[model samples]
Target: MKPLVVIPARGGSKGVPRKNIKELGGKPLIYYTIEAAREVFDDDVICVSTDDKEIKEVVEQTGLEVPFLRPEKFATDTAGTRGVLLHALKFYKEEMDYKADTIILLQPTSPFRTAQHINEALEKYHFGLDRVVSVKETDANPYFVLFEENEEGFLKKSKEGSFKRRQDCPKVWELNGAIYIINVNSLKNEEVSEFRRVKKYVMDEVSSIDIDSELDWKIACSIYYNIIISRNIDSK
Candidate 1:
């Protein structure tokens, strides 16, 4: 099956100005995703979808193509990721005559994901899994979560279950936004598969950092510094 790697980046970043192109560790943050994609797929299968020219250039330098720039409406801060991805898929199908069996998303925000992670997710995705995403076990269990009244100042349990300990509540996973492999036709209208068909590809916390905020950027840098940068390996 043919696999396509897609990277979505918006020019207007409220958290960190030009966040996608911002220097993290040493290279532009987009470089990480670009390199990781290149490692797993050929140049023809990797593409960058961004509204920013700088991002396009950076992606091009890494040998990835910016054949299309995402529209401004879908690049806004409030825009959901599903919109950008669906638009990109439509653009490729109609304009470029490309139809991939699987479309994998490698968000530029999560810079620490490696080529191995991509391969692992793909293995699961091709094994009849509709959707596979990189996830890490959430530290806070939903079983112990509380819900406060929006205005009336009332408090209650968020779910029906109340476990004696967080570990006893079973496992809950959070979409790290690092990687997602989905069937191309499955995203016809931007709605990912229902939770029932969605599968999780477990990743370590160190590799699951999604840098959308200033605070998140700092934390990512620290984690990378300790886990990757300091290890003397050429970071992607």
Candidate 2:
């Protein structure tokens, strides 16, 4: 099935400041995602949806298409991810008359994904699966170790507290938001319907980094550097 790559980048970045365009390892952070997509898909099929002119320029420099800019309203901090994704999907269909069986939603903050990881996720997305996302084994399983705050301000366990041993609890998956390949039908039908069947392409913690803040950025860099060092072994 044909695929379309969508990179959603907005201008206002509060955490890291101009994060999407910021250089990571000498290349703009978004460049990694664009490059990986290029390695796996044609340039015409890849699209970067952004609101900032600077971000658009960075995307074009990578030789990717910025088919449409997300509306300022939708690009605001208040706009939810679901709304942003729905708007992007609608834009390509309505404005560009583009259609793809698979809509690949890749977050720029996740730069560690390799072309191999992308292909692995795609391999899981056969006709049987409705959606596929990059994920990693969670160190702390939410089913066992998570907590919830009650209205009385007491910290209560998210699940039953009776499970005395962490190992006894079932393992649960946490989405790493790196790469997601969702069926276009389910995407337009309900904006990533929670009820839709989903699959995962599990990656190691090193490559599964989700850079949400300064700390996350640091951790991701460490992981990236480590991976590079390992690859350089015996090359000398």
RMSD of each: 2.6, 2.3
List the candidate 1 regions with Cα displacement exceeding 4 Å.
Answer: 148-152, 193-195, 233-236
Error of 2 at 95 (Å): 4.4
Per-residue lDDT of candidate 2, residues 1-236 (tens digit): 97878888888888888989888878899998888888999887787878899999878876566877788888888987666767776776787787677888888888988788898888889756678888887767666778889999998778675677888777767788888988877766675656368887888877777777899888867766777557757467
lDDT of 1 by residue, 1-236 (tens): 87777888888887888889889888899888888888888887787888888888887776666898788888877888777777777777788798777789999898889899988988787635668888999886667764545456777656658588776887888889998988766676346735346788999988888998999989988887887866657543
- Model 2 poorest ten-residue lDDT run: 187-196
Model 2 misplaced regions, further than 4 Å: 150-154, 161-163, 232-236
How much is 208 displaced in model 2, in angstroms?
A: 1.0
**Which residue pairs collide, candidate 2?**
none
RMSD (Cα, Å) of model 1 = 2.6
lDDT of model number 2: 0.80
Query: Which one wins on lDDT?
Result: 1
